[model samples]
Target: MDEVPGVPAGLLGGHPRVLAAAAATGRLPGRAALDDYRAAGARAAESGVPLRVLVETALVMAESMDPVPLPALRRAVSALMEGYENAQRLALRQEEVARREFVDDLLQGRADRLAERAEHFGLRLAETYAVAVARPAVPLDDGSVRDGTVRDGGGVVRDGGGVVWDGDGPARRIEEAMVARFGSHNVLVAVRDGGLVCVVPGSLTVATGEFTHHVRQMFAPGWRVGLGRPHRGPGGVVTSYREATGAIELGDRLDLRAPVLKAADLLVFPVLLRDRAAIEDLVTTVLSPLREARGGPEPLLGTLEAVFASQGNQTAAARRLGVSTRAVTYRLERIRRLTGFSPDDPTQRFTLETAVLGARLLEWPAHAPG
Candidate 1:
C-alpha cells in the first residue's frame, strides 16, 4: 500500500494494523475488528483520501493474508466504504448548513458573531464588497407565488416577479462556476427567494457581466441582473444586498428591458421615493389630468412614455406605440393642452418624464390615491 503511487501519503500508516486484526477472523471479520476498520476509513475520508485508493489498498492487503476468506474481506471492505461515504456526506451537509446560515446572518444584518463567521467563509470584513443578484426575466414557477411574504430572510418580496427560492440546483451550479472562475476565496453565491445572489469583491470589474452570463448560460435568456455598489465591512453586505433587491423590484415595476440593472444608475428613483408625499403630489398634479383623455389615462400615459423613451422622435414613438405618426402627434398635442406640458420642449419634457416615472413607481391610476 505504501508503494502505490496513487495512494495518499500517511493514509496507510494505521490501516495495516486494522486490516490484520480483521483478517484474523478467518471467515468473516468480527464486529470489533470491522468497527475499528470503519473508524479508520472515516479518518482517511476526512483527510481527503480518495476512496478508490483506499479500496485498492485493502484488496492488495487481503491478497497477502492467508487466513482471511475472500467473502469476509469483501464484507469488511464494504463496511469501510460505507463509513467513508457517510463521513463525506455528513461533511458536505454541514458545510451547506454553515453557508446558508452565514448568508442569512449577513444579508439580514444579524450581527451576532458575524465577524467570526465571516472569516470562516473567506470574507474579509475590512475590505469593500459588492453584491450582484440575478434571476430569470420570466419568473419561474416556484410554487411560492401564493405563499405570502419572504420565507428565508433574503428580502425576497412580492413586488413584481418575486424571486422564489427554488431548489439547490441553480445555486449550486452558479456557486461551482464562480468558484472555478474566481477561485474559492472571497466569493459567495447563495439562493435567496429563488434567485442567485453573488457576493464578490468590489474590485472585480466584470463580476456583474460574468454573473449574468453564467445565469443566462445555465438558465437561458430572459434573465435579469441587479448590482449594488461596493461598501465596506459586515454592514456593507446588508446594504449592498438591499440595494440589489431594490434594483430588481424597481426594474420590474418600470418594465426595464436591460439585462443588468445597477443601483447607481437607479439612484434617482430612490431619491424620488424618499418623499412619497411629494412624488404623489407631483404625479397627481402633473399627470392626473391625462385621466380626462378618451379611453382613460393608459393610452396617453403610454404615448408619453414611448415619446420620452424615443427621445421626441414622433415616428419612433409611433412605431413603439404601433400607431401612426399622426396619432402620436395628436396625443402630444392633447397632452400639451391637458397638462400645459409639451413633449416638444426640452425643459417641459423633463418634468413630464419625471412625473411619468413617478406614476409607474407608484403604480398610479389603478392604485392611485383618491
Candidate 2:
C-alpha cells in the first residue's frame, strides 16, 4: 500500500495484509459478524480471486492527493474504491454461505461426539434431555435458530454444543447471548427451533431437583418450553421432545408452574393402585367393630398408635394424640367399651398400634371401640 501524497505522513492506513489479518483472525475478542468476514475471505481465496486486486485497491485507497494533483490518477483511485466496494459485497455473501455450510458440518460432526461424551461422563444419551431452545432477542419463527449458535441434531432435537459449550461458562449464558443476537424476546431455542436443550441424564439425584428449579427460571413471558420424559437414547429425543412439548401445552392449560414433564411422575398413580391390596384387608376389618364398642373407646387407630408408641404413658399418649387430658379420659372410656382392653394396660398397646398401622395404611374410616 502506498502513502497518499499531501496526506499527513502519520495517516497511514489501508494495508491489505493488515485488513486481511484483522478480518481473518482475532487480536482481541470476536463477534458473529467477524466470522462472516473470515468466511468471505476464505471463499474469495478458494474461488481463485486474484489477491492482487485486493492489494491494489488498498494502495489506491491509501494514496492522498497532496503536492502532486493528477486528474487521471484521482479517477483511477475512485475506480479502485468502487472495486473495493464490490469486493466487500462479494465477501459478505460468500461469508454467509460459508457460515451456513460450516454450521451444517459442525452440527453433523458434533452430535455423535456429544452422545459419546455424555456416555463417558455417565450421561445416558438414551435418557431424555430437557430441550430449551432460545434465539436472539428478536422474534424468530417457530423452530428457528441462528447459524453457529444452535446445531441441529435432526428431527426436532438438536444435541447441545458439547465441546464448544464446555469452557463457555454455564450453558445458560450461551442461551442469553443467542437471545441478544436475535434481538428476540424469550424465544424457544430447540433443535431447528429456538430450542436450548439440556440433556438431563436419566439418573435422578438431588441435583436433578435443582436442575428442575433452574429450568423453571430459564425464560420470560411469551416463551414456552417442553421438557420431555426420560428417553432411551438420542432417537428417543424425538419422543421426549414431543412429550415435553405436550407437557408445556398441558401446563399452559392447567396453570402449572413448570411445563416440563417427567415419565416417572406418571408412575405414582400406578404405585398407589398396587399398594392398596396390602392396605385394605389386612387389619381394618378385624379391629373396626371392636374399637367402636369399647367402654374406653377412642378413635382406635390414633389412640392405639399413640399408646403403643408411648408404651402406656397417658401423658405422652395424650400429647401424641393432640388431645387434652379430659378428652383423653373421655375417649379412653369409650375404648374399653368394646375392645375388652384398656390402653392403660401394657399388653394391649402392642396390639393397638399394630391395628392402628393396619387401619392407617388401609385409609379406613375411624371408629370408637364400643
TM-score of each: 0.81, 0.30
Residue 210's lDDT within candidate 2 is 46
Encode model 1's per-residue lDDT on 71-171: one tens digit a residue: 66677788889778767765665566577778888999898998898888788878999999887644443324446543322323232454343334555
What's the lDDT for all of these models? 0.78, 0.43
* Model 1, residue 53: C-alpha shift (Å): 3.0
lDDT of 1: 0.78
- Candidate 2 residue lDDT tens string, 1-370: 4443443332223233333444345332234433433443344444544545533543465343232233333333344344444455445444433433333332244463555544432345544343322222233322223343423221122223211211122234434454454322222222233444433444433323443444445444445455455556555655555555455544443333444445344333234336655435435444655534544223554666665667667679799778876776766666666555566666665555545554543345433222
RMSD of each: 6.7, 15.9
| Residue range with the least summed lDDT across 10 consecutive positions in model 2 | 161-170
**lDDT, candidate 1, at 358:** 95
